[model samples]
Structures are given as structure tokens and as C-alpha cells.
Target: MKLGTLVKPLLITGLIIAGPAMAAPSAQQVLAASPVDDIVERYPAMMSEGIREGLKRSPQLPPMVADTIGYVVSNSFRAADIEQQIVKNLERDLSGKQLEAVEGWYKTPVARKISAVEIAASDPAAWQQMQAKAAELGKKYKGTDRARMFERFDRAARATESAVDTTIAVQLGLATAMAAFSPDSANYDELKRKIENQRNAIRGVVEQQVYDSYLHTYEKISMQEMGLYIDFLESGPGSAFSKTVTQSIQQAITDPIESIGNQMARFLAPQK
Candidate 1:
């Protein structure tokens, strides 16, 4: 079957996975329950409008891109579970009002603003303009640590973007595998094996890329921030970390991203 033929079922699988569960559902069951029309209807007005415009303007962007973009817009718009976990993690260090303020941004009309930005970013002219602006900023701030920091930030941003793309590929492969497992299919077992193999391959690629790229950048930025804090503590009346404790704490925080990367690999890796 064509890739577009799988889009509806994949979306249904997403809804089931994202929804509340009495009992765990398999990928196939989730695909069977998905309502494609309902999924399309749930998209935000701005997204629908933008998708229409994109197809008109590009005319060559594959139908799959439109479908994938629609799915992304829909999922991101309603990713409450992911957002809630992010908020819960942040709340450990933030006050109640601060948490509320952060959550409030998600409810605003910001998605439309972001959609516009994405549209602009996709345009060749606009992308060139952005690169030119970046060069201008680099020249203006040359010779300062701030410029160095900006360069690091740019690198981190690119790494994060790569991480996101890898993640999407992993998710799509998993979804496709799940969609292929139907009881009526005579070659169900063979199809399942193919799916599992693909899932494993994609998961491995994503996990390694995330570790080598984003995780390393994260460690650098984090160490830079911690250095400022350490300098303050050393210069002031109080110091929280003795040299031994400082080394221990830095390792403690930095070690977990590696663990997280491993866990992601295990979670996405297909069962033998």
C-alpha cells in the first residue's frame, strides 16, 4: 500500500496511545479504532488554512508531506500528556505562579504565530535572510564571549533540530509497523518481522545521533551555567559544594542524559 494509505490508521494509533486506557492496546487495535475524518476535523483552523496555502504555493510537496504536517500540527496542538510531564519536571524548581505562567503560553494563540514562522522558515528567500542576519550578528559581536556563546547556541539549535527529525522518523517507523499487523493478512508474521527489524534499525540510529549530538551540546551548556554558579559560591560568603561534592554533583546531573538515551533506545527497540 502507498504511504498516504497508511496515514489515517497511523493517526488513529496515535489517538489511542495518547488517550486514557483501561487496558493497554496493541498497535494494530489502535490503528483499527482511529477515525481519519475525526482526526482531520480536529486540526486547528490556522493549520488547515496553512496546509491549504502550502499545497497551493509548492504544488510539488508530496501529499505525504501535507499529511505528515497535518499529523504533526494535530499532535503538537494536543500533546497535553507530554506538556504535563514537562511542567511537572519544571515545577520541582519553579513556584506555583511561575508554573502557571509557563502553562498559560500553551493555551494562547501562539500556535498560529508559530505556524506563520514555520511557513516563513520554509521559504528559500526567508531562509537566506535568516542566514544573512546570523552572519551580521556574528560580525557585530566578533571577539566577545557573547559571540562564542551565540555560536554554541546555534550549534545546539541545529543539533536539537536533528534530534527532532530523528525522533519523528522513529515514531513513524513504529507507527507503520503497528499498522501492518492485521489478523486477516495471510503474511502477518512475515510483515511483523519486517516491521520489527525496521523499528530496531530506526531506534538505533536515533539513539546514537541523540547521544553524539544533542546530549553532548546539552552537557556543554549545562557545565557553562554551573561554572557561573560555582564562581559565585567560591567568591561569596557561602560555598555549597566542596571540590569532591562539586565533582560528584556535576557527574550526577550529567550522567542521566546518557541513561535517558539508553532508556529511549530500549523503549523503541523491537522485541525479539
Candidate 2:
């Protein structure tokens, strides 16, 4: 439903599809074809100022300390290693052909164009621009058509769901990290309860972001190019590729949160 992974800073960020197999892609081939690299490289977008923002919530924390967290998030977040990890993870489930197909689609002029848009969207300028366009697109799809456009993207890369999953994963990650980071500051159980309680609200937030992000990413892409991407998403291999990558990203996000919990437990443990 969402990436809903608790990633590290402990905060961050799955999918589905299936079919009979041709030869699956080799690890190298999959890596060569898939957009995992680009996604990894662009990951800073998912993280900008978040670690610091979360730290700001702590009244006892000093600004310098908060800045340290921000530095780790913005400067030292190891997205490339995580990307390598994701490539390995997705390769476990996806076939060569499937991976190749996904790579092929992304390699097309339209998909490359979309890639450029996505890279830009990860930054403040592009997001601002996309936000404006999403508003316009929202207007264009108003009333009964508003509901229809939500349905409109089911086949088009399932862009909406993918966006929601990524956003949720990040939130879950941040909440998880916050709980561990402040284990002694509040009742951990109560904090986790609050996180669970807000899941739906968070989902609503992610949904809107997805809607805006899709419009934002596709702003420069021609309708014809957009249509091709949609067709690829609907295809058997493409669908699997999307699912595998989404799942891989979720797992990548999930691992750091788990590590934070374990690490925190040790950090708080009595020194025997």
C-alpha cells in the first residue's frame, strides 16, 4: 500500500506483478537496464531537510546538534551503497527479460525525458514547478473527472501507488528512528501507537504527493511518450520490473530502521 519502510537517519522508505518467464536478466544486465541507479542517485530528494526538521521537534536539542543530523541526511546519506543493495535485492526476484524490458523502456527517448524531469522534481525548483502544474492538472480533471484521473493512472506506471509507497516508507522510517532516538524521553509504546494512529493521515498525504509528483515528472514528457510508459507499466515484464524495484526500495528503507532499533537498544543498554 505504501513503501511504509522505516529506513535510516532511522527514517526512509514495495510492488507487485507476475508472469511466466523467459530468461531472466543477469545481475549485470539488470543493473545496466534498470533505472535503479537514477533512483538511487536522485534519493536526496526524499531526504532533504527531513532529518533536521524532525530533530527540530526536540525542545532540548541544540541547533548545532540538529545541524549535524541534517549534515548526515544531506551530505553523508549513502544512497549509492543502498542503490547497489537494491540492485542485488531486485535481481533476486526479477528475470533478465523482465529487467531488460524495464531497462529498454527507460532507455527510450520518452523515458529518458521523464528521467530528466524526475531528477529536477527531486529539487526545490522542479517540485515547485510540478506543484503548480499538478494544480492545473487537478483543475483540468475536476468534478467527476477528478475521480477518473485518479483511476487514470492505474496502468500508467501505477505512478500514483509508486509515489505513495515511497512516501510512506520514508515516514515509517522517520517515525521508527524518532522512537528509537528518544526511547528514554517518552513511552515507546505510546509513541508507536501515535505513529500507527496517523497511518491513514500519512497515506492521504502520500496520495496527494503522488498525484502532484506524477504530473510534475511528466510535465515535459509528450503525451505520446507518457502513453508509451503507461503501456510499459501495463505490460507483464514492465509490471514485474516496477514491482521488484518498489519492493527493493522498500526493503532498503526498512533495513536501516531495523538497524537503528537494534543499535539504539544496545546504546541504551547498561554497560555490564
Candidate 3:
């Protein structure tokens, strides 16, 4: 037939064929679409509050020692530093389609609502409220379908897993700080093993804490909203994004602590 008609068809076919080769969302674009950066930005302050509470519980902990640990944690778990590392890891791990899908989901209305709740819950005051009302909330949700659904959501979101990783990271930071004052510093492996040996115990605590926190955080979010969020998390791209972010966060926090023992030791050392 006509030359113009033939060229139009060819152009359409070429575009269709090239669609899959289009550039994926950049790491910053994906992060910007998600709540990850916001959540990470609050980490240092949250950690400081956690340490303060923990120190309160540890009446035996010397003030100087507590101060040292605080200093180390504050310096070591910088939000910008962690976010930069997470971007690097996500860049390496996420596929173009996966990143695009994750960005799409995070941009949704439901995700925005849930993300707001999560960000608010990340606050120290929110944590304190959750802790204070944990027992009451646990009883209210117990034996209900809501609780069951929450379990599924938690599993999909890797909530407990991430919490455990955070617990381990905090412990590792403390150990690294303590090592600074010790005569013989434990190597990374030894410190890791020592921390990991308590993983089961740590998981038990984090599991309950995560559950309670979820209940409190999502209390305002309707069941339908939570269900939609869960569906996203269970999807292939969602699962991958959840897993990648969790691992990236763990690495960002731990990588510095792994070698921080030496630096902290030197910093805490007496002037020569």
C-alpha cells in the first residue's frame, strides 16, 4: 500500500519492541517515591532515644560509658551516610522493572497514608506510647482476624526481620563502643558471633515489639487500606523492594560498626 502507512506501522512496532529497554527509575527517583529516606532520616534521633531509655534501664551502666556509647552511635549511624549506602545497594540489586514497580506502588494514595503512619510511629514519643499501651493493644487484637492479617502483613513487610536486624545493629554498636575501652578488642567475627548467638532471644523480643508497634501504628488505618498495603508487599516487586531495603539498611548501619571499634578506641584513648 502507501509508503507512509508502512513507515507508521514500522515505527509503532519499533517503539513497542524498545519499550522494555527504556531506562529504569534511578535510585534517587525510587527512594524519593518511597518513605525510606524519611524513615532513615529519623533513625539517629530514634536511636538516641532508644539508647537513653536503655541506659535508664541499666542502672549499673556508668555515665561515662553510656556517654561513650551515645557518642559512637550518634557518629556511626548518620542518616545521610546510611541513605547513601542504601542507594548504592539498591542500585546494584534492583532491576529496572522492579524499581519502576516499587516507585509506582509507593506513589499510590494508600501507600502514602500507610507511609505517614509509619513515619509518625517512628518518632520517640510514638514509641513510648506504643510501649505504654502494648499490653492493652495486644489484648484487643488477640484472636481476631485483624491480628491474623497483621501477621501476614508483618511477614510480607519483613517487619520482624528488619526489627531484629536493627536490634543486632544497635547491639553491635554498643559492643563496638565497649571494645574501645577493652584491653583486647574483639574482631568483627567474634563480635558478630557473640551478637548472633543471642539472635533467637532477640527475635522473640523484636517479634512482640514489632507486633505491638504495628497494631498501634496502623490502628487508624482501615482494614481495607491495610489489605491493599499487604497485597502490594506480597507482590513480586514489592517483596524484592522490601527485602532489598531491609538488607541495605542493615548493611549501612553495620558496615561502619564493623571497623568502628578501632576508630572509637583511638578517639576514646588518653592523649599521648
Candidate 4:
């Protein structure tokens, strides 16, 4: 699948979008707050990076070709459009308290540290050290506990589910785009029907890739730290924040994924 083309219409949803006005702060004020702005600034770059990585995995595609296509499509992806969608959602659903909670937690030292690690999780330099540490730590815990810890870490980082879902969405987009753009002589419905048969297989493959990436990303983060992060995600404010962002993102992508998945064989990203 051409990932760049797939994510071209991805409307990024997040926790720090514009929310209601209350005693805590106005929607505009929340937008101006720290960490909120920080995250907002990062999404465009992240979106571009994510698409680039996805394109790099296309079977037999030349690096330059993939890079060029990814770059062009990502460049055309308007951050403003995404923000507007987020704003619309936030305005309708999030309460002032929820907004403040997101802001407050992100302001915390622990949250800052976690976010920094996450932001750098894809970096080569950081991965070298993190992976080495993860190897050491993996041996420290054995059996059931280690397995349990792995699940905790993966969920906290949203590694497995998000990746799998995103890939599913992208692949569906590819199938849809292919059908939509095909010539009059082409059988779009026939192509869609063929894709439908492969959807489950693509999902299964994507799930495996997600698990591998999760294991790698969490390699440096200690089990104890993972526990704490898990706690934060399950906490009142933390849970609210995580759920709000996750739900919004899920909502934004779910339609496209279902639309495409219902028609095309999923475009499976090459496992890293």
C-alpha cells in the first residue's frame, strides 16, 4: 500500500484539543497552555514521519520513489484540517475538568519524562541504548511476571493496538484509492470483492508486527516504570486523558478502516 496516500486524509485526534470554557480555563486558554502546544506542534512532523516509515516498507519500491511519494503526500496533509476536526470533537465532548486534567498531567515531571522517551522511541541512537537495557531487563524478570509486564508496557505505550489499527486503516485506504482511481474498463467492485477475502489475513499479519514493535520499544523501559505508566493511564485524570485522545483518534480512523476493510484486502506493512 502507498502509506502516504493512505494517511493523506488522516485527521489526527488527541487529548489536548480545544475544550469547553469553565472556571478552570477557556478553550482558547487551554490551547495556549504548555505541553498542549508542544504536542500540537509535533503532530505534523509525526504524521509525516509515520507515513514515511510506512512507505519505506512497500514491497520492491525504490527508496527514492517511496520517499518522494511519502514526502509529497505528507506535505499536502494540512495540519490545520486535522486540528479543526480535533477542535470540533473537543468542543462537543470534553468537559473543562477533563481538559485541565490533560494539561495538568502533561505538566508533571513523570509525564514529561515519559513523553520524551516516547518521542525518541523511534530514534536510532536512543533505540541502541534502550534495546540494550531492555535485553538486560528481560532476563531480570522471568515467566508469567515478564509476560504480564510486557502487556502493561505495550498498553501504556499504545504500541500494539494503534499500529495494527493504523495499518488496517492505511491498507483499506489503498484498496479504496485503487478502486476509485481505476479506469472505466476496470472492475472496481470486483477488485473490492477480492480484497475483502484478504482482510483477515492482513489484520493477522499487522498484529504480529505490532507485537514485535511493542517489544522493541519497551525494551529500555523498566518493568517498574511500566507499572507506573500503566497506573497513570488507569488513573482518574490519566484514564480520562488517554481515553479521550484514543477514542477521538479511533473515531477519526475507524470509518476509513471499516470502509476499506469491508472492501479491500488489507495492505500489510512489512514487519520491522
Predicted candidate 2 versus true structure: per-residue lDDT over 46-159, tens digit per residue: 564655666678775567765665565555346776676667766776666666677677777777776666666666556566766777777765664333544556544556
Instruction: Estimate the Cα RMSD of every predicted model relative to the unseen true structure.
Output: 21.9, 14.3, 3.7, 15.0
lDDT of 4 by residue, 105-204 (tens): 6666766666666555545345456546655545554465646665665666465566555555555545443343334423545655666577678767
- Model 3 TM-score is 0.83
Task: Please provide, for model 1 over 190-249, each residue's C-alpha lDDT reduced to its tens digit, 9 standing for 90 to 100.
Answer: 543654466556556644443332222222234455334234324311121122222232
Which clashing pairs does model 3 show? none
Error of 1 at 111 (Å): 23
Off by over 4 Å in 2: 1-25, 57-62, 74-77, 132-137, 140-169, 172-190, 261-272
Predicted structure 4, TM vs. truth = 0.59
If both were scored by lDDT, which would come out higher, candidate 1 or candidate 4? 4
Q: Tell me which residue pairs clash in candidate 4.
A: 134-219, 195-264, 195-265
Error of 2 at 75 (Å): 6.8
Q: Which should have the higher lDDT, number 1 or number 2?
A: 2
Give the runs in model 3 whose Cα sits over 4 Å from its true position.
1-24, 179-188, 265-272
Worst 10 residues of 2 by lDDT: 12-21
TM-score of each: 0.27, 0.70, 0.83, 0.59
The number of the candidate with the highest TM-score is: 3
- Model 3 weakest 10-residue run by lDDT: 52-61
Candidate 3 lDDT tens digits, 176-241 = 655655678786679879999999999999898888988899999999999989998999988988
Error of 1 at 175 (Å): 10
